[model samples]
Target: MNYKTTKILWKTFVWIVLIIGTIITLVPLFWMLSTALKSNAEVMQFDMVWWPEDPKWSNFVEAFTTLPFGEWTMNTIFITVFTIIGTLLSCTVVAYGFARFNVRGNKTLFIILLSTMMLPSTVTMIPQFVIFRELDWINTFYPLIVPSFFGNATFIFLLRQFFMTIPTELEDAAKMDGLGTMGILGRIILPMTLPALTTVAIFQFNGAWNDFMGPLIYLSDPDDFTLALGINFFKGENNQVQWNYLMSASVISMLPSLLIFFFGQKYFIQGINLSSGIKG
Candidate 1:
């Protein structure tokens, strides 16, 4: 084949693959939305229904108003916001130290930190529960929010990678201008690392927003339940599962994450690339 013809064929193949992948990914989401607008009768049928004959737009209103979804949503937002703040603050400071400061055993410590990521959370779950129980943190936001203030190994690693990419000359100039460590980090380092920080925040936000296990374990009060937990209860409240309402609630719960990801996609991709090895 001619070179130009071969290149065109390759591009066509890639586009075909991407289109197929997109359809596969979107199918489940489309199904979920389709089911949300369906009736129980339609949902139970052996024959698959791609779309409902009469779409129940009211399912969203009913699902949202039937439970304390508003309260749960607020609770989720509070936890997610706090979690992002704690993660950013703690991870930034820790990453800055590892990236900028020359300290004895810094490399060793960083390796040790990275190693902790390999340790499964299942291994520490019991110990963490016991500690939190001892502190009387159960059924409290403390259990959910407090841990994020301690640096997450994955986020620290990403931030540290991005931090190392920055030129040291900026720090040198800041020092000459009498900017302290915090000042340099705030004014010079953070502005440049916006992509990475946004990536971290988005990760934390999605994790916190969708978190089920943590809230399930730590929060006992119904009023304090997050969306995930609340959805579980929503299913349990009915003897026969109302698939329509369940899917509707789920669709509602996922909207914030969907919106955030769609809006921040550019920054998120950029952050991942820069942290992977690209210099700032």
Candidate 2:
């Protein structure tokens, strides 16, 4: 084949692969939405339906009625918002200090922080639970929100990398204008690192929103349950599963994260690229 024709054929193959991959990724999401709109009979049928024959919009209403969805949603949102704020505040400050300071043992401290990420959470889970219980944090949101304010190793590492990419010239100029370390960070460095910060916020938000284990461990009251725990309970009742209602609740739970992503798609892409040191 001619070289031009060969190049075109290669591009076409790549495009085809990408399209297939996209479809594969999206199919499950579409299935979930479709199942949410189905009746119990439709959901249990031998053959699968891509779209519900008789769309049951009332599935959402029934799901909400069947569970303490309002309370769970409020609890989940509160925990998620606080955790995101804590993570952003703690991680960014620590990362900025690591990036800017040259004090003794700084490198070692940062190394130790990064090393903690390699240790599995299971190793610390029991000890952390004991500590929280001793401190009367169990059965409350404190255990979930408080520890995060101290900072996360992964988040610190991501922010630190992004902070390292910034020019020292800005900080120097800020100092020339009488800005102290904190002042420089606030006015000069942070504004310039919005993309990286937004990236960290997104990760923290998603983690808090979808957290199942932490809430399962720390929270006990049905009244205080988060959506993750509440949703799981929807299937565990009297050993019977309600597939249609379960799927409907799951779709409702996903809406906030989905909307956040769609609206912040541009900033999200920028943040990920910047954190990875990829320039477009």
Candidate 3:
């Protein structure tokens, strides 16, 4: 084929695939919304309603009133915000150190850090719980939010890779101007790595938002419960599950991450590409 004709054909194929993929991904979300609007009887009907026959918008209201949703939401937000801030500050600093400086035993320390990532969190769960209990941190937000301040190994590694790609000449120029390390990081390195920071913030927010197990184990009171933990309250001792309410709550819970991805999508893609060691 001629060059123009070949390019047109490739573009056509890409569009077709994207449209198909979009439909596939959106199907479940559409179903969730449909289900949320459905009444219990309509949901159980043998003949499925593609959309609600009489959409019960009150279900969302009922979902909130049935539990201490406001408190739960506040708790979740607190955790999410702190986790994002902590991960960004701590991970960026650690990654900068690893990428820019050569300290004695740095390699060995990095290897140990990476090794912790390989170890299953389940193995450390009990010991971690005991330590938290001793510190009187149970039933509080500490156990959930504090760990992020130390940084995540995987995110550190990702940020480090991106930092290493930055040209050293930029730092050299900054140094010649009498800029200290913190000044260079604050004025130059950080601005240049906005993509990576946004990416890490998004990931940390999602992780904190979706976390159920950690909250389940650490939080003993409903007042301290996060949104993920609050979802379990929709179940009964008799195993009668409130599927509609659960689905509605889940849909609502997913909005923040979706919004973050929607708005910061460009940075996210750039971060992924840069962190993968590709010179775009």
Give the range where candidate 2 is weakest over 10 consecutive residues by summed lDDT: 233-242
lDDT of 3 at 96: 97
Best by lDDT: 1
Compared with the true structure, model 1 gives a TM-score of: 0.97
lDDT of 3 at 75: 96
Could you list the CA RMSD of all candidates, in the order they appear?
1.4, 1.3, 2.1
Model 1 RMSD vs true structure: 1.4
- At residue 196, give the lDDT of candidate 3: 94
Residue 224 CA displacement from its true place in model 3, Å:
0.8
lDDT of 2 by residue, 1-280 (tens): 9999999999999999999999999999999999999988888889978899889999999999888899999999999999988998999899998988999999999999989999999999999999999999989999989988999999898888888888999889989999999999899888988888887887788888989999999998999999988998767658788888899999999998888888777888887787788988
Ranking by TM-score: 1, 2, 3
Where model 1 places Cα greater than 4 Å from the true spot, the runs are: 237-239
> Model 2: how far is 165 from its true place, Å?
1.6
Flag the better candidate by TM-score, 1 or 3.
1
Error of 2 at 212 (Å): 0.6
What are the runs in model 3 whose C-alpha is more than 4 Å off?
A: 1-17
Candidate 1, 160-213: lDDT as tens digits: 999989999999999999999999999999999999999999999999999999
Q: Residue 256 in model 1: shift from native, Å? A: 0.5
TM-score of each: 0.97, 0.96, 0.92
